[model samples]
Target: MRLLFVFGFFVTYGAVLTATVNNPWPNFSGVIILWFMIYLITAPARRRREYWENRRALQEEYWRSSIRYQNRYRY
Candidate 1:
């Protein structure tokens, strides 16, 4: 999926660049809009990935602390 996004971006960028070679203003604006659109499209996926990473870290910390507490109380 990520690879697809990257590939698509490069392909679209190349096409847009070629198509707008004679028009500098449109070329610049098109590239900017393309980047913004890609960012918006990927925002949800990025958020979800961050959320899972944070959750995993919290779970690992909880387990580590619990194990340490148990060991300290053991006779």
Candidate 2:
């Protein structure tokens, strides 16, 4: 489901961008900026940051526990 959502989003974005790219770059960039702004506006900034911190902490813990899984999951 998440894959579908992501795929659909990219497909829509690429279709729009390519179909209208000759229309203008600034307009495309503006839309990109607006997309991120909307995302940030709706996202819980503090909670998301905390979630990331917790995620990193868990990753570190998991790495310390097992070198194999640690290497497997590294960014």
Candidate 3:
């Protein structure tokens, strides 16, 4: 996480420097646009990962309870 923050800092700063050197506002926003695009692209994958994680956890709990119930009723 710390490394990610440092990398992000350098990337944004580097973009700013590049834009300033070129003096183009439209292209300057390209860095922000690129990041937004990346986020949009990954959103689905991220949600899918979370969905499966939750499903697995719920299934585990369900089976645990089922086993406990069966044991309680055993002769």
In model 3, which residue pairs have backbone atoms overlapping below 3 Å? none
**What number of backbone clashes does candidate 1 have, counting pairs of residues 3 or more apart or in separate chains?**
0
Candidate 3, residues 25-68: lDDT per residue as tens digits? 43546667666666777799989999999999999889877967
Off by over 4 Å in 3: 1-18, 22-30, 68-75
User: Taking the tens digit of each residue's C-alpha lDDT, what string does model 2 give over 1-75?
Assistant: 974686557545754665554665335564566566556664788578889999999988977889787587576
What TM-score would every model get versus the actual structure? 0.60, 0.32, 0.52
Ranking by TM-score: 1, 3, 2
- lDDT by residue (tens digit), candidate 1, 46-75: 899999999999998898779676697687
Q: Candidate 1, clashing residue pairs? A: none
What's the lDDT for all of these models? 0.74, 0.67, 0.72
Which sections of candidate 2 miss by over 4 Å?
A: 1-43, 67-75
Best by TM-score: 1
> Could you tell me which residue pairs clash in candidate 2?
none
Clashes of 2: 0
RMSD of each: 4.5, 9.6, 5.0
lDDT of 2 at 70: 57
TM-score, candidate number 1: 0.60
Q: How high is the lDDT of residue 27 in model 3? A: 51
